[model samples]
Target: MFDEFRAKRVLSRCVDLRKEIYNLPSDLNKLRKTDPKKYNDIKIKLRDIV
Candidate 1:
């Protein structure tokens, strides 16, 4: 039972990672053009998340 729960949690996190990776580029670009500080923050977060 514990193993099953762990597997589901990991799978959900994998989906989250996929979404983050898909959206990251456009997000980074928008931030870069307007908010350099926020862009750097996002880059660090991406490195940690992905």
Candidate 2:
């Protein structure tokens, strides 16, 4: 029972992380074009998060 609960929690976290990464690229591109410095910062943080 505990294992099942832990598995569900991990799976939910994974899904949320996937969504964040999926949305990040477009935003990263926009930042890259408009502000290279901020873009790099975001890219690095996103990499660490993923």
Candidate 3:
């Protein structure tokens, strides 16, 4: 019973995280369109760090 409850809690948390990931705001695409230079800079920095 405890294991079933823990599994359900973990599954629920995963579902919540997936929903948050899918519903995230798409500002990067907008930035790419509006200010490409800044976007490229960000991309380059992310490339180096990530």
Which portions of model 2 show Cα errors greater than 4 Å?
26-50
Which residue ranges in model 3 land beyond 4 Å of their true spot? 1-26
Question: Model 1 compared with the native: what TM-score?
Answer: 0.50
Preferred candidate (TM-score higher): 1 or 3: 1
Put down candidate 3 lDDT per residue, 1-50, tens digits, no spaces: 56998888878766766675466447989978888997787666546433
Find the candidate with the highest TM-score and give its number. 1
**Clash number for candidate 1:** 0
Q: Between candidates 1 and 3, name the one with more favorable lDDT.
A: 1
The lDDT leader among the candidates is: 1
Off by over 4 Å in 1: 26-50
Looking at candidate 1, the ten consecutive residues that score lowest on lDDT are 20-29
Give per-residue CA lDDT, model 1, range 1-50, as digits (tens): 56998888878877887886687666667779999987787677668755
Provide the lDDT at 9 for model 2.
Answer: 83
